[model samples]
Target: MADDFNSQRATLSCFEENKPVFDSFKVNIGKGGLGHGLGEVEFAHSPLEPLKQEGDNKAPIGVFTLDAVFGYEEDIKIKMPYLYATKDLICVDDSESSFYNQILKTPKVMPKSFEEMRRDDAQYELGIVVGHNKEQIRKAGSCIFLHVESSEDAPTAGCTSMKLEDIQKIVSWLDKSKNPILIQITKSQKDEVLKLYPMLKLEE
Candidate 1:
């Protein structure tokens, strides 16, 4: 009899400033409390500056919890709770607004200083919410997510983007019961991770 929680945990890691166009990430599955490399994905920016502010365009370098999975499809299947981003759904980025960094479904009426979750482009066709700065820390960044890349070589606005197929695989691979977490790292933090958890493998 084995505990499923410890075995199913997944870690998504990325190195700081790894690439000029897009950063690379590796997704691994935890087995017997050790991380087994599952596959690789691309993220944007190594994030030189802190990610606690808007317009940084730098992906946060730290561990964040996977909150929710969203897609435009009506019946998309995934390991976590899924939501369909309607045309009226938006995430408030206004630091002053009480709803800052919060997603709201406001049908028929558009709000100012908000980001529409539903977009004409396919970049957000499917996205996974990253619980970064979830406390709504003013000016500490907002609307961070793991989503699809518009172009294979283009960078994202402080988000981890991947190919549609890859994102789908990641969403499917996640296990909610395991408390799956994403540990986005940088060059500086690499040694710390390796020192703390040698079981986790890092690939170039």
Candidate 2:
């Protein structure tokens, strides 16, 4: 987790059957920091903290499912369901549209606002769909994913990002049958998170 709600960088670790699968790695989060999101569990946030919004640029804080894998490639060898991010594929971000927070092919439905799944940069070359706000809550947050970082290793608009090799490793390791999930939170919320998921061995 980040040191605080305002931090854009944090350490990420992977585990399998309560054993470390790989050494902890660094990752870049939302440029605007972190905020409460719709996830597997709800967390109590201070009045000062903000809830995730459509364009807040804040990474969601809570447990979320790793729904699928997406990339610019036509096909991938990953075990999870893969999405080929074709030129026509877009993720709707328009809260007013019926397809809010959904990924769809263009021309079939046009929303006022949406993000192209296929990008010119390498950021979207490989990515994982994070199951945040699956209920399509208006302005709650949308199109969240675990994707490759930019060339500069800069922060994302809201998605979590890491080195291409690192993200690829994660994507390859993920198994749909395992029902993989992501737990994201600040250090201050560690104790509470432990109470809910005691199996986690988070560092002090």
Candidate 3:
């Protein structure tokens, strides 16, 4: 565990390669200052190709800050910020839109090329916003999130997806004070991260 990981919780998803589906696990660092495994979790990504532009169906590779626990149900208890996703919720991905890569709050109308957070498939029933191209870089990527997987074998359109139960456990355990982060580095990049954050461990 890194000393700099002041947070009480973190989710580490390691990839042997950017193969779309990878082994993932969560860590809970309590007052004792030691990490305990929450359990094993699996995530899916797009198989089309490596993540690049919008709609590539590939997940981005890098460390990302987790923001906003959102779901259709308003009763989900979490220590972090929460938003009850409604039909009005939209994640604008349009390159021309000034709000690219950001979720609009209570929009009266949907923006062009935006994802409806509230969907009939229930995939967005519970999710966390992933900070990939979050600075609103036009067409870099958008609507990245950690949400419910459509199927165990199916891949995501770019975001990371997992079992609903697994996601609920991870989200409910998150603590805002700890500033939990999601590390999505490839196996090759693992060595570099270890050199910088010696206390951190990347599992394959």
Candidate 4:
């Protein structure tokens, strides 16, 4: 978890059946830090911290499913459901549009605003879709993912990012049958988070 809401970096650990998959690695989060988001577990809104909103640059804080794997490639070897990010593919962020939070082929349904899945950068060359605000919660944040970091290792708009190799490793290791989920929270909220997910045990 991040040190706090304003933090841009955090240590990420992977486990399968409670067994460590690898040593923890560092990852970059949203530039604005973490904010409460719609997820498997609900957190009480704190006046001190903000709730997740579109373009907030805050990574959502809670448990979320790893829905799918997407890339610019036509096909990938990963087991998760794969999506080819064609040049015309876009993830709609315009809350007012019917396609809000949905990834669709361009021109078929044009939203006022959207993010191109196929980018000139390598960051979107490989990515895993994070099921944040899956219910299409308007302005509650959208298009979250675990993707490759920028060349500068900079923080993302709201997605989690890391070294390309690290992201590749994670993508290869993920199994849809296992129902993998990401649990993100600050250190201070560890105990509370564990209580909600009794099966999860973090190192002291």
Per-residue lDDT for 98-147 in model 2, tens only?
99998889856589999999998888999999999999999999999999
Model 4, 99: alpha-carbon shift in Å? 0.6
Best by TM-score: 2
Quality of model 3 by C-alpha lDDT? 0.62
> Residue 19 error for model 3, in Å?
26
- lDDT (0-100) at residue 116 of candidate 2? 98
Question: How high is each candidate's TM-score?
Answer: 0.73, 0.97, 0.73, 0.95
Model 1 misplaced regions, further than 4 Å: 1-51, 107-111
In Å, residue 167's CA in model 2 sits off its true spot by 0.3
Predictions in order: lDDT: 0.61, 0.91, 0.62, 0.87
Best by lDDT: 2
Residue 96's C-alpha lDDT in candidate 3?
Answer: 81
Q: Which of 1 and 2 is ahead in lDDT?
A: 2
Tens-digit lDDT string for candidate 4 (89-166)? 899999988888887788664789999999988989899988889889888988999998995458989999999899
Q: Of the pair 2 and 3, which is ahead by TM-score?
A: 2
For candidate 1, give the lDDT of residue 184.
59
